[model samples]
Target: MYGEGDNQVKALDEVSLSVNQGEFVLIVGSSGSGKSTLLNMIGLLDRPTNGTIKIDGVNTTTLNDDKISAFRNTKLGFIFQFSNLLTDLTVLENVLLPRQIGGTTKTANKDATDLLKAVGLESQINKRANKISGGQAQRAAIARGLVNKPSIVLADEPTGNLDSVTSETIVQLMKSMAKRLGQTFVIVTHDRQHFGEVDKVITIKDGKAFEGEDDPSTASGKEMEVVA
Candidate 1:
C-alpha cells in the first residue's frame, strides 16, 4: 500500500518466503510484478504493511529506523542496477568506503584488497570510476558490497547494465564468494540463462511467489549451492 485508500497500490499481497543460510536464491518477475518491492522488504529498505520479514531469526519489521539502518549495513549488502560508485573515489577507496562510514578498523584494508583481487580488479585498484569499464565498475561495486561482511547480499538487476559475458562473470563471482563466505544471497534478475546455474528458483507473479518450474511467463528463480 503506497498511498491513501483509493490511490493505494498493492505491491505485495501476503507474500511469504524463506531463504536459508548460504543459499543463492533468485527472484524473477515481470516489470510490475513487485520484484523490487519484495527485495526492498527483505533488504529492510521498505517496511511491510502486513507481514514480517525475518533475517537470521530476527524480525526486521520490529526494528526502529536507526536500528534498521545499522542492521542493513552490518548484516546485508546491496547491489543495484547501477554500480553507484562515487566517481571521485578510486576503486580501492570505493570498496573501503563502507568501512569508513561504519567507523570500522583499518585492518579491513587487506580484506578489501583481497576482494578486489578476487573480482579481477586488482590492477585497477587505484583508478577512479571513470577510468574503468562498465564491467570493471560493477565488479568494484561487488567488492564494495562485500567489504562489510554482510550475512546476506541482496542484488536487484545486478547484471542489467552489462553485456552477456560480463553479466555471467559477475554472477559467477557472486556465487563463488557466497560459497567461500557461507553467506546467503537473494538476487532479482530477469536473465533466464543464469537460471539453471542457481540452486532454487522462486517465481514472482502478481505479487505472489511460487517455487520450482512453475510458469513460463514468470522469470524462473534458481537457487544453487556454491561448489568448492
Candidate 2:
C-alpha cells in the first residue's frame, strides 16, 4: 500500500509463497510488476506492511531494526541488477567488504578466495572493480554475496545488463553454487530460456502469485553444469 484512503495502491495482494532449502526458484514478471518489491522484502531491504516473513523457521517480521541488520549480515545474500561493486575497491576487497563489516574478515579470508575462484575471477582478484569486464564484475558480486555463507541468495534481475552468453554463465554459476553448498536461491528474471535449469518458477501478475509451468518448447540450451 502506497497511500491512504482513495489513494491507496496495493502492490501485492494476499501473496504467499515458499521455497525449499537448496531449491533454485525463479520469479518472473514484467516491468512495474511486484517482483522487485517481493525480492526486497525477502532480502530484508524492506518490511511488509502486513503478514509475517519467516526465514529458516524464524519469524523475521518480529525482529527489531538492530536484530534485522544482524540477520541480514549473517543469513542473507543479495545480488542486484547492476553489479554495484565499489569503484575504488579491488575485486577481492569488494568481495571482502561484507565480511569486514560483519567483523569476520580474518576468519572468512580463505572462503572469499575459494568463492572468487569458483566464479572464475581468481586471476582478476587484485584488479580494481572498474578495470574488470562486466561479466567479471558480476562474478565478483556473486562472490561477495556468498562470502558470509548465507543460507539464501536473493537476486533481482542479476543478468539484466548482460549479453545472453554472459547471462547464461551467471545463472549457471548460481545454480552450481546452490547444488554444491546446499544454499537456496530466489531469483527474479524475465528471461524464460533458463527455466529448465531451475526447480520451479513463480509468476506474479496483478499482485497475485501462481505456480508457473515451463513449456519444454520455451526452454533453450542444456542445463549448465560447473566443470571440475
Candidate 3:
C-alpha cells in the first residue's frame, strides 16, 4: 500500500509463500508485478501493511526497529545488483566488514578468506575493490554476504550488471555455495534460465504469488521446460 483512499496501491495482495531450510528459491515476475516488494518483505527491509513474516521461526513483524535491525544483521544477508563495495577497501576487508559490525570478528578473517576462495576470488582478496573487475567485485560481494553465515541470503538481480557469461557463473556459484553451506537463498531475478536448477520457482503477477510452474500446455510453461 502506497497511499490513501483512491491513491492507494497495493503492491502485494495476500502474497504468501515459504522457503525451507537450505532451499534455493527463485522469484520471478514482469515489471510492476511486485516481485521486488515480495523480496523486500521477505528480507525484512519492509513491513507489510497487513500480514506477518516469519524468518527462522521469528515473527519479524512483531519486532521493534532496533530489534529488527539486530535480527537482520544476524539472520539475513543481502546481495544487490551492484557490488556496493567501498573503493578503498580490499576484497578481504570488504568481506569482513559485516562481521566487524556484528562484533563477531574473532574468526572473521578465516571465514572471509574461505568464502572468497569458495567464490573463486581468493587471488583478488588483497586487491582494492575499485581495482577489481565487475564480476570479481560481485564475487567479493557474495563472499561478504556469506561472511556471517546467516540463515538466509536475499539477492535482488545480483547479476543484472554483468554480462551473460558472468551472470551464469555468478548464479552457479551462488547455488553451489548455498548447497555446500546449507544456507537458504531467496533470489529475485528476471533471468528465466535460472529456473533450471532451483528448488522452487515463484511467479508474481498482479500483486499475487503463484508457486511452481505454469501449465505445461501454455507457452510460458513450455519455455520454462526448455530452459530447465
Candidate 4:
C-alpha cells in the first residue's frame, strides 16, 4: 500500500520475505533506511500502512490491539538499546515485569530466577536494576525478554550503548541462548564489524530490501526463492 502520497513514507517497499522459526536474522542498513521501522513492524509494535506481516503463519494486521498484545506476550520477545528495566525494581523483579502485563505475575518468580541465571546474572538478582552497569542491565533485559518464552526475539541495536568488547560478549551470549532455546531472532544493527558469522543479512535502502548476505553494488537477491 506504500505509493505516492505525502504521508506515505516508503519504510518498506516491495519487501517480501519470511524468516524461519529458529533462524537468526540480521537486518543491516545505515540510518533512515527503515531498519527501525521494519523491526517495529516485525516486533508487532507498529503496523504497516500497506503489505502483510505474518508471524508463525498468522497475518498480524488482522489482530486487534488486545489480541496483538496478548499474542506478543506469548509469542514474541523484545530487547532494545536501553534495557528499560524499572529503576525501582531489582534485577529479578525487572525480569518478572512482563508477567505483570500478561497477568501471570503471581507465580513468575521461579521463571524469572531461571531466566536470570540463564543470562549469567544470578548473582545480580538482588541488586537494584539501576545499580547495575550498562552491560549488566542489558543482560537483565535479556532475561526479561525470555520470561514469557516467546518463539521469536527481536532486538533493536541491543548493544548500542556498550564498549566493543562488552558488545561482542553480549551478542554472543544472546545468540547462544537463542540457539539453545530454538527461538528466532531478528537483529537490526549498523555495526558492520560483526558481520562475518551472521546466518543471513538483509540490507534495506530507501525502504526497499536487498536480500541475501549484505552486499552493496551487487545484484539484489530478492527474486531468488527464499528457503524459509
Give one digit per residue, the lDDT tens place, for model 1 in 1-228: 789979998887767676888889888878898889989988898898886788877888889999998888899988888999999989999999888888885787998999999989889999998889999999999889999999999999999999999888888998999898898888898885764567767777787776654463544443322111
Over 1-228, each residue of candidate 4 has an lDDT whose tens digit, in order, gives 344777755677766667878888888877988888888888888887866788888888899999999989989989999889889989988888789889887669998998888888889999988899999999998888889888889999988888898898788888888888988888988775753476667787777777755554573656422322
Candidate 3 residue pairs that clash:
none
Clashes of each: 8, 0, 0, 0
Q: Candidate 2, residues 1-228: lDDT per residue as tens digits?
A: 668999998887767887888889998877776888888888888888888788898888889999999999999998888999998989988999889989987767788899999999879989999999999999999999999999899998899889999998988898888899999999998876854567877777666666664332343312322110
State candidate 2's TM-score.
Answer: 0.91
Instruction: Give the TM-score ranking, best first.
Output: 3, 1, 4, 2
Model 3 residue 170 distance off true place after TM-score fit, in angstroms: 0.5
Error of model 1, residue 104, in angstroms: 1.0
| Alpha-carbon lDDT, every model | 0.83, 0.83, 0.85, 0.81
Worst 10 residues of 1 by lDDT: 219-228
Please, what's the RMSD in Å of model 4?
2.3
Clashes by residue pair, model 1: 198-223, 198-224, 199-223, 199-224, 200-222, 200-223, 201-221, 201-222
Off by over 4 Å in 2: 214-228
Best by lDDT: 3
Model 2 lDDT vs. the true structure? 0.83
